[model samples]
Target: MIGSLDIAIICIYLLAVLAFGWMFYRKQTDASSFTRGNGRLPVWALSLSVFATFVSSISFLALPGNAFAKDWSSFVFSLSIPITAFLAVRFFVPLYRKINSDSAYAFLEERFGRWARIYASVCYLLTQLARMGAILYLLALPVNSLTGLGLEQIIVITGLLVLLYSTLGGIEAVVYTDAIQGILLISGAFLCLYFILSKIDGGFGGMWQEALQNHKLSLGSFAFDWKSSSFWLILFYGFFINLQNFGADQSYIQRYMSAKSVKDAQKTVWLGGLLYVPVSLLFFLIGTALWVYYFQNPLPEAIPADQVFPHFISTELPVGIKGLLIAAILSAGMSTLSTSVNSSATVLLTDIFKIETANSLRFLRTASAIMAACSIVAALLFLGVDSALDVWWALASIFSGGILGLFLLGLLVKKSAAKLAVSIGLVFVLWTSLSQMFPESPWAFTLHPNFVIIIGTTLIFAVGWLLRKKD
Candidate 1:
C-alpha cells in the first residue's frame, strides 16, 4: 500500500490541477473561448498541449506494458506521426484554417451535405467516448489495485474532478494543464529509467547485454503477414491512423484552430510531432529496463504486463517519489480526459445542436458534465478488458473508420456524388461493425486491427471515385 505521504502528494497534485484550471474561469466569456481558447496561447504551449493530448494515459500505462510483454513494433506507430504531421502542415492545416471553424466537421457540411457533417460528428463523438472510457479505466485500474480502492470509486473521483475543472474553466484550462502535465509525464518516465538503471548490475552496459541476450531489443517482425503484428502492417496502419489523428481528430483540430494563426498552428503540429518520438522512446526504454530488472531479480510469480509498472511503484519506490510518479499518471489521465470532455461538448453544441442561445456557456458546461458522466460509464464498461492497448486500438480503429473515410472522400475526391459518398461511408460503417463483432470469423480474422483504418479509408476513396465517375 502507498504511504500517507504518497496519498497526500497525489491529493496536492489534484488540487493544484483544479487551481490551475480555475485560473482560466474568468477568460471563458463565450463558446468560442470556452471551446477554442483565447486565440493567443503560445505556439510552444499549444505544441506541448498537442503532445500531451496525443500521449494520454493510454501511452503512460500501455507503452511500458507493451515493451514488457512484446517488443518495439508499436514504436512504429509513433514513428509515423512526423510523416503525417508534415503532410498535415503542408496540406490539411491550410484547408482547415481556410475554413476557419471551431468544429472540424464543419468542412464536411460544406463539402458533402448536412448528413455528412452529422455522420462524421457522430463518429467522432463515439470515438472520443470510447477513448475517454478506456483512458479512465487504464488510469483507475492500477491506482485501485495499489491503493485498495474500488474501481468505481476511483473512476467517480477522478472523473468528477476532471469534470469540475473542465466544466468551470473550459479549453484554456485543458491546454494549459496539458502543457504542465506533458513535462511531468516525460520527467516521471525519465526518473523511472534512472532508478531502474541504478539498481542494475554494471549499470547501462549490463542492462544492454541482458536485454540483447533475451531478445527484448527486437524491433518487430518484418514479414508481410496480415494475421499478425508485422512491421509493414503496423507501418501501414500507423501511416493511416496518424493521418486520421492529424487530419480529422477533433482534439488535435481544436488545438490547430485555437492557435493565433495558421502558421503558428502548423509550427505547433510539427514541433509536437518531433517531441513525441523521444518521449515515446523513453517510455519503451523504461519497459525494457523493467524487463532486465526483473530478470536479475525475478518476482515470485508473473504479473500482467499492464500491472507490472504500478506494482513496482507500490512496492519498490520510496514514498515521495512514488507519489510523484502516481501524480504523473493522474496528470496524464486528466490532461486527456479534460480535453475530451471539453471537445466532446464543443461538438455537441456546435455540430449536433447548433445552439446559439444567450446562455451558451451554461449549455456548454452542462454538455461537458454530461459527456464526463458518459465517459465514466464507458470506462466502467471496459473494466473486464485484458489489454488496455489492444482494446483501445480496436475501439479507435472501429470508430475512426467512417469519419476518416468520409474526410478522404471530401478532401481528395473532387466532384464527389453525395449518394456515392454516403454509400461508401455506409459500407465502411458496416465493415467496421461486422469486423469488430466477429473478429474470429475467417474473413475478419485475417484483417488485423492495425490495418482497419487503412483498408476502410482506401475502400471509401476508391469506390467513391468510381461511383463519382459513373455519376
Candidate 2:
C-alpha cells in the first residue's frame, strides 16, 4: 500500500513541474515560441527533450514488462538508431532547416501538392494520437495496480496536468521540463537496477549467469524470417520507424527547429539517438533482472506482465523511493505527452488551419486542450490491451509506415510525384486494411504486421522511381 509520504512526494513533483512550466507561459506570446521556441533553445536541452520523447512510459513500464515476458530480442529496435541518426544528420537535418518552416510537411506541399501535405499531416496526427494514447494508458496501469485508483481517473488527471504545462510554457517549457524529466527517468531506472542487483544472491554476475542460462539475453533468431519478428525484421522496422521519426515526424522536426543552428540540430539528433541506445539497454537489463528476481522468488499471485514492474515497486521499494520512481514514470509519460500535445497543436495551427496571427496562441492552447481530451479518451479505449508496448508498436507501424514512403517519393523524385503519391496512398490503404483484417489468411497479405512500413516504404519509392517523369 502507498503511504502518505509517497503520495505527498508524487503530488509535490506534479505541482513543481506545473509551476516551473508556468514561468515560461508569458514567453509564449506567438506561435513560433510556442511551437519551436524560435530556434533559440540550447542543443543539450533539446537533445534530452528529444531523448525523452523517444522513450516514453511505454518504455519505462512496457519495456520491463516485455523483457520479463520474453527476451532481449526487441532491443534490436534501439540498435538500429545509430544508422538512422547518421542519415538524419547527413540528409534530413539540412533539408528541413533549409525549408525553415514551422511544419515539417511544408516540403511535401512544395514537392507534391497540398493533398500530399494533408495526407502526411493527417498521418502524423493519427500516429501521435496512438502514441499519446498508448503512453497515457500505460502510465495508468502501474498507478492503478499500486494504488487501486481507477484507470480512467488517473488518465484524466494526469492528462490534464500535462496539458496545463504544455499549453502554458509551449515548446520552451516542454523542452526544459523534458530535460529535467529525462535525467529523472534515467536516474530512476538506475536506482531500480541497483536495488534489484542488491537483492540478487550473486549480484551482477549472478544475474548475468541466470539470464544467460535461461536464454533471456538472446537477441532473437538471426535467420531470415518475414512472418515473425526476427532480428532483421525488428532492425528493419526500427530503421524505417526512426527514419520516419527523425526525417518526417513533426515532434522531431520541431525539435530540430528548436535548436540554435543546423549544426546544433544535427548534434541534437546524434546525442538523442545515441543516448537512448545505452538507456534502452538499461531498461532491458532491468526487465531481465526482474525476471530473475521473481523466478528465484515466485509470486503468491500471478499478475499481468505489464503490472509486474509496478507490483515490484509498490511491494518492495522503500517509502520515499517508491514515490520518486513513480514520479519518474509519470515524468516519462508527461514529457512525451506534453511534446505530442505541443507538436499536434503546432501542426493543427500551421498545417491544418494555417493560422499565424495574434490569435494563433489562443488557437494553439485550444487545440492543445482538444488534443489532450482526445488522447485521454483514446487511452480509455486502449485499457484492456494485452501488451501496451506491442499495441503501440503495431499502431505506430500502421499509421506511420507509409509516411516515409511519401517523404522519399518527394525527396528522390524531382518531377511532380503527386500521382505516384496518390497511388501509394491507395495501395497503402488497401495493404493496411488487408494486412490487419486478414493477417492469418494465406490468400491475403500474411507477412508480419511490422513489415507494413518496410514494404510500404519500398513500394512507394520503387514505384515512383520507376515511373519518374521523363524530364
Candidate 3:
C-alpha cells in the first residue's frame, strides 16, 4: 500500500489541476472562447498540448506493458507519427485553416455534403468515447490495485475531476493542463528509467545484454504473414492510422484551430511529433529495463504485463517517487479525458446542432457534461477487457476507417461522389466488422488486422474514383 505522504501528494496534484482549470473559467464567456481559446496560446505550449492529447494513459500504461510482453514492434507506430504529421502540416492544416471552421468534419460537409459530415462526426464521437473509456480503465487499474480503491470509484473520481476542469476552463484549460501533464509524464518516465537502470547490476550495458539475449530487442517478425504482427504490417498500419489521427480526428484539428496562425499550428504538429518519438522511446526502454530488472529479481507469482509496471511502482519505488509517478499517470488520463470532452462538445455544438447564439455556451457546457458522463459509462463497460491497448487500437482502426476513407476520397479523388463515398465507407465498416468477428475465416484470415485501415481507405478512394461517373 502507498504511504500517507503518497496519498497527500496525489490529492495535492488533483487539487492543483482543478485550480489551474478554474483560473480559466471566467474567460469562457462564449462558445468560441470555450472551444478554441483566445487564439493567443504560445506555439510551444500548444505543441506540448498536442503531444499530451495524443499520448494518453494508454501510452503511459500500455506501451510499457507492450514492451514487457513483446518486442519493439509497437514502437514503429510512434515512428510513423512524424511522417504523418509532415503530410498534415503541408496539406491538412492549411485545408482546415482555409475552411476556418470549428469542427474538423466541416470540410467533409463542404466537399462530400451533410451526410458525409454527420457520418464522420458520429465516428469521431464514438472513437473518442471508446478511447476515453479505455484510458480511464487503464488509469484506474493501477490505482485500484495499489491504493485499495474500487475500480469504479477511481474511474468516477478521475473522470469527474477531468470533467470539472474541462467544463470550467474549456480548451485553454485543456491545452495548458495538457502541457503541464506532458512534461510531468515525460519526466516521470525518465525518472523511472533512471531508477530502473540504477538497480540493474551493470546498469545500461547489463540491461542491453540481457535484452539482446532474451530477444526482447527484436523489432518484430519480418515475415509477410498477415495473421500475426509484423514490421511491415505495423508500419503500414501506423502510417495510415496516424493519418486519420491528424487528418480526420477532431481532437487534433481542434488543437490546430486553437493556434494563433497557420504557421504556429504547423509548428505545433511538427514539434509535437518530434517530442513524441523520444518520449515514446523512453516508455519502451522502461519496459525493457523492467524485463531485465525482473530477470535478475524474479516475481514470486505471475502477473499480467499490464500490471507489471504498477506492481513495481507499489513494491519497488520509494514513497514520494511512487506518488509522483501515479500523478503522471493521472495527468495522462486527465489530459486525454479533458480533450475528449471538450472536442466532442465542440463537434456536437458546431457540426451536429449548428448552434451559434448567446445560449451556445450553456449548450456547450451541458454537452460537455453529457459527454463526460457517457465516457465514464463507457470506461466502466471496459472494466473486464483484457489488453486495453490492443482493444483501443482495434476500435480506433474500425471507427476511423470510414472517416479516414471519406477524408481521403475528398482529397485524392476529383469529382468525388458523396453517395459513392458513403457507400464505400459503409463497405469499409462491414469489412471491419466481419474481419474482426471472423478472423479465422479464410478470407479474413489473410487480411491482417493492422492493414484494415489501409485497405478500407484505399477502397474508399478507388471506388469513389471508379464510380464518379455513376454519381
Candidate 4:
C-alpha cells in the first residue's frame, strides 16, 4: 500500500497545479488571450510547453517499458525528431507565423477549399481525443496499482483535475503549468535513474554489460524491410508524423502563435525538439538499468512490459520519494491532457463552430468540458488494454489522414490541391480499413503499420501532382 506521506505529497502536487491554474484564470479575458496568450509568452515557456506536451505518460512509462521488454527500436522513432525539427524551423514555423491564425487548419482552407479545412480539423479533433484517452488510461495504471482504486475512479479524478486547470487558465495556464510539470517530471526521471543504478551490482558498468549481453541496446533491424519496425521504417514514420505534428497539428501551431516573435517561435521548435533526444536517452537507460536490476533480482512472475516500471514504483521505492515520482507520472498525463483540451477547444471555436469573439470564451470552455467528458469515457473503455503506447501510435498514424501531404501540396505545388481531396480521402479510408480490419487477409496491407501515414501521404502527393494545373 502507498504510505500516507506519499499520498499527501501527491495530493499537495494536485492542489498546487490547480492553484497555479487559477492564477491565470483572470488573464484569459478574451478569446485571443485564452487560446494563444496574445503572442506575449516568452520563448522559454513556450519551448518547455512544447517539450512537455511531446513527452507524455507515453514517454515517461512506455519508453522504459519498451526498452525493457524489447529493445531500443522505438528510440529510432525519436531520432527522426531532429530532422523534422529542422524542417519545421525552416518551413512550418514561418508559415504559421505568417498566417498568424489560432487554427492551423485555416492555412488549409486558404489553399484548399473549406472541405479540406473541415476534414483536417475533424482528423485533428479525433486524434486528440484518442491521444488524451490513451494518456489518461495509462496514468490510471500506476495509481490503481498503488492505491487499490479502480481504474475508472482514478481516471475520473485525474481527468477532472486536468479539466479544471485547462478550462480555467486556458492556453496560458496550460503552457506555464506544462513548463512546471516538465521540470518536475525530468527531475523525477533523474531521481528514478539514480536509485535504479545504485540498486544494481556494478552500477552503470554492470547495467551496460547486461544490456550489451542481452542486446537491449539494439535499435532493431537495419534492413530494407517494410513489414517490420526497422530503423529506416521508424525513421520514415517518425519524420512524417513529426512533420504532421509541427506543420499541421493545432496543438503545436498554437505554441507557434503563443511565442513573442517569429524568431522566438522558430527557436522554440529547435529547443523543444532537440531537448527530447537526450531526455529520451535517459529514459531508455532507466529501462536498461531496470532490466539489469531485475536480472539480479527476479520478479515472482512475468508482467506486461507496460506494467514493469509501475510495479517497481509500487513495490520497491521509498515512501515520500515514491509519492513524488508518482506525482511526476501524474504531471506527464496532466500536462499533455491540458494542452490537448485547450487546443481542441481552440479548434472547435476557430474552425468547426466559427464562433464570434463575443461568445468564443464561453464556447471554448463548454467544448473543453465536453472533450474532457468524452476523454474520460474513452479512458474507461481502454481499461485492460495490453499497451497504451502501442495503441496510441497505431491510432495516431491511422487517423493522421495525410495532412502533411496536403499541406506540402498546397504550399509547394501552389495548385488548388483541393481537387484531390476526395481521392485522398478514399485512399485513406481504403488503406486504413484493409490494414486494420483484415490484417490476415491476402489483400490486407502487408507493410508495417507505421507505413500507413507514409503511404497515405505519398498517394496524396502523387494524385495531386497528376491533377495539377499550370499556374
Per-residue lDDT tens digits for candidate 2, residues 337-439, read 9999999999999889988597999999999999998899989989888998888888887787488887887887887455665577557756765767876
The digit string of per-residue lDDT tens for model 1 on 96-211 reads 88888888999989888898888878888998999999899889966986699998999989999999999989988999899999999888888878988998897889988988
- Model 3 misplacement above 4 A: 438-446, 469-471
Between candidates 1 and 3, name the one with more favorable lDDT.
Answer: 3
TM-score, candidate 3, is 0.96
CA lDDT for candidate 2: 0.90
In the predicted model 2, the residue pairs found to clash are none
Judge candidate 1 against the unseen true structure and give its global Cα lDDT, from 0 to 1: 0.85
Clashing pairs for model 3 are: none
Looking at candidate 4, the ten consecutive residues that score lowest on lDDT are: 416-425
Residues 1-471 of candidate 3 have per-residue lDDT tens digits of 799889999999999999999999999999889988867788988999989987898999899999999978899888899899989999999999898888999888878779888888888898899999999999998898679899999999888888889999999999999999999998888888999999999999999999999999888988877667798888888888888888988888988889999999999999987788888888899999999999999999998888899988888899899899999999888898999999999999998998868789998889999999888999999877768888888787777755777787788766766576567666766766796798787766345556667777777777787777533
| TM-scores for the candidates | 0.96, 0.97, 0.96, 0.98
The TM-score of predicted model 4 comes to: 0.98
lDDT of each: 0.85, 0.90, 0.87, 0.88
* Tens digit of per-residue lDDT, candidate 4, span 318-358: 99988999999998899999999999999999999999889
Instruction: Mark the regions of model 4 whose C-alpha exceeds 4 Å error after superposition.
Output: none
> Model 4: which residue pairs collide?
none
